[model samples]
Target: MNDADNRPVADHPFPRFSDQELARRRRAVHDLMEEAGVGHLLVYGSDRSGSAVPWLSEWPVTREAALVITPNGDDHLLIQHYNHLPNARRVARGVEVDWAGPSTMSRVAQLLPAAADQGIGVIGPLRARDHQLLSESVGELVYLDAQYTRLRLVKSDEEIERLREAARFSDLSVAAIIDQLEPGMTERELAAIVEGSYLAEGATNHIHYFATTPMASPDTCVPAQFQSTRRIEVGDILFCEISAAYWGYAGQILRTFIIGADPTPLFVELHDVADDAYDAILSVIRPGVHARDLVNASAVIEERGFTTYDDLVHGYGGGYLPPVLGSSSRPNLPVPDLHLEQGMALVVQPNVITPDQRAGVQTGQLVVVTGSGADSLHNIDRGLGRIG
Candidate 1:
């Protein structure tokens, strides 16, 4: 485990968690099971979305996969799609891998203990049909999705290192777009540039959203959740929210760019307010800081008569974990009564948009909470981006 930790990440054809790190995760999950009085834990995933499958077995769930954890440390991992078996076996650590066959839930039900004292604790996004199957097979089915999310809030040392690598890849993606953006290029081309930067480096796209509009007569504020075919034009503002992942760990960054011209006065003001709000929020991001404190710091944006379209701050590096907060001007979710911890990572974006929702700017990156303050994992320049 020590040797693997010390070796360069590029040396491994596929990234892996060290044995020690895997053991720690198993122990933590076992503790959770004990607390919940569940004899077994079934971590399920489909279409590669659930964070728990990869968090436990290091096999990022592809078509479908489920990790059944028992107290005896003899865990069984079932993978769907016969072709995905080889890779799952190669990458999954500390588990017995098998084919999940025609019915994934049936395979899971068969593997679970016939009788558990507190029933079966399940995590991940289970389809209603599968949920019913599991419930029928086992008398009680306890949903522990929220509890599993809480378990991922504070990262471990190895996890933090992986997050730093993810952040570097995210920075590279954003920088590639900034350097190659041209007036004639389409947003689809921009998306290609972002992925082209890091795909070869074994990083996958978590998300790359773009919003391009004429700065003179703006039409959009926040970056669209999906890319568009609209071509970039001179005097257009292009803002993006991008995250590139190394394995399942990912880094998020938001940046706004002006194509083929300098920013106008209004754009400058909007970006300045976003930058100030980013700084203000970061200033109070030490361990033990309440979630509301970060929101309060962002009051600068509203004071400057601007609003935000996206979340002001959100936990990152492990499934958008907790303390998802929005500015006072626009509260996305109830301000979570959560406090920052030393190893917690967050993206402090202040997507300051105009009150009329016609214009906005993106400016922020992923940062980890330290004992004294927050430390940015990304090295990209934090100034307003300009391109030709």
Candidate 2:
């Protein structure tokens, strides 16, 4: 979505999901659970990525959270820490948000029936201890991770608008970096400045401020968060990854900039190849296309004699969901073979690796799938450029 469409900028500490939207999400989950013969369901997650917690409820999990749903359409939350109970009350509206008493499973067991056919379905990664407890309490716990992923893969209209705002915020963050970036500044200093800019613009959370340059050791195509106190040098081809989150939705922009180096043949070729591969995938993206089809279309990198270093493409909003279109050498197995659906958000970057898993240009764009093709979420130049 463009500023011309007049959407709100991504910023805010709390999330935004209207009552109707929330009802729609719950109904979707309920339908899935009922179809799977799940008598009870648990959507487990934490705040690290806000994985399934925010998706399940507007409530952001501080450390741990579980949204429990019964076949009777009753919804509840087993959140941690008694001190955070007030937070639950404020954010987790309508649900029975109760303190899960350090022993989460025990609390979950209390709310659920002790029947062998209860078939408690779980949707996130669980610790062994928690799993054991759940097993004992619920009898048979079913894995529904993929089912949940499928349910969230196609975002709703409201979600698409929020993602658009998030993407716009991230795009603006890149622009902020260009405006503030200068030599003589340490990567850490640059990170702080960039992060602060996004915060001011209303991003409630930050994804990261990572930087890599040709001068740096271990040239991996992957971008690394700036850690060294060493100052950025001249003549170095640098890559930076910036992402910002509004409420819980995330958007990212990855690009490379030349310090003082002349555009080397290697640099230009890698950037151009990655760009072409990006376009190739874009050319085939639309409703009903298989995810692997996009991965297969991105063979230009290998055809041009370059090793890949990162995921050619992955998703966002659900904090990195599946359908990851990977490199040709190690393409991701699109298990279940998910088809491209409208309103799916993804960040595509063909990170070119130079033989030894060491560095190459890592640039990308965030896009939402459309009926005919894909819409670019961020408005930044795709080609590499020199800061000098």
Candidate 3:
């Protein structure tokens, strides 16, 4: 009865969205900003990684780029480079443009006047680059980000439908990886298969990839050994905390699997404890429940024979919208009081460690809040994932 035995079932496929749908998502952003009393929003991107900039503007902001949404409902796409100006303009349909000089943030700062004078409530908080620019230009104009995030949390029916498809694809992708898993296979090799399968199935991103041996610290990223020559071996466990985008919605899926048996007693016991934790958490999820109470309830799993890592649950949405769900952070959870409401999506992952501290195990599921309870979008087998 090792904890590793109860792995979630995986069965889904890749996801895609139509152009009209993309446009609709952007419009929704504007509408939300207006409703929140935001005079203007300055959305910026510093890196090429996951960003809400693309989600809102429909354009990827690689360099110094920002999206300005005014109270009048008008929008603007500002960038430092002239070369990407065309690409930005192409992606921005109705939004105005303000290409600025690369060396200084002054040009972009000039746009903050309306935001400062009337005290524009910012949507997405300005990043380092843009924050510095704003400090110099607008000072502090009652900046805020909660309203914008709340609007995203309660997904529209269309958005829910898209997320459902993405979850389906995530499940299928994991199953495909499981089908490809075998003893002696390197972790890197397995990751490639997992990622490749997602693409072949039509996925554009590898939301995330985490795997490792039962006794090893969780592999949360693609290791470099993948390039050399490493392979999987017996007694190994493959765990994944990944997601994908279908249309404009996001699908988050977590999975765990084991290779050739000879299971450790601790692994078996903790894996089952992890299962109980997963089920317990799932049982209490529903609309009206405060995120903190959910975490408190899940804390009992530790009392029942398991150790916990991170929070028991966290909020999730398209891209990486935050106020991460659940009451698990420094001292206590910091997210403002928000009840689990129908249409809100979440990921409940409960990782367990043995009393001895030698082994750690976990099980997590992605679910959507319903009127009564919660509906799971991800369905991976919760028993020990065994390979022949």
Tell me the deviation in Å of residue 388 in model 3: 2.6
How well is each residue in 1-388 modelled by candidate 3, as lDDT tens digits?
0011122213112122344665676667667656655556666655453255666655555666666666465666677577877656644444576576754356656776656654455544366775666766776644545555665787766667767777877777678777877777766676666566666555555466554654444333211223335466777665566676554455777666667765667667767766776777788878887766666666555565655544457777654443364423222347557777888888887666544444565567678888888888877676667766
User: 202-236 in candidate 2: lDDT tens per residue?
Assistant: 78545654655654453556677545676777767
The lDDT for every candidate, in the order shown, is 0.88, 0.75, 0.61
Ranking by TM-score: 1, 2, 3
Which residue pairs clash within candidate 2?
11-202, 219-358, 219-359, 220-358, 220-359
Global Cα lDDT for candidate 3: 0.61
Off by over 4 Å in 1: 1-11
RMSD (Cα, Å) for all candidates, in order, is: 2.4, 4.8, 8.8
Location of the lowest summed lDDT over 10 successive residues in candidate 2:
1-10
Ranking by lDDT: 1, 2, 3
Overlapping backbone residue pairs in candidate 1 total 0
TM-scores of all predicted structures: 0.96, 0.89, 0.78
- The RMSD (Cα, Å) of candidate 1 is 2.4
Q: Which lDDT tens digits does candidate 1 get at residues 1-388?
A: 1122345445767887776887898888899998888888899889988889888888898999988888875788899999998877777777888899998888888887474555789998889999888888876888998888888989999999999999999999988987888888888999999999999989999999999999999999999977778999999998889999999999988888888898999999999999999999999999999999999999989999999989999998778778999899899889988988999999999999988999899899999999999999999889788887
The positional error of residue 271 in candidate 1, measured at the CA in angstroms, is: 0.5
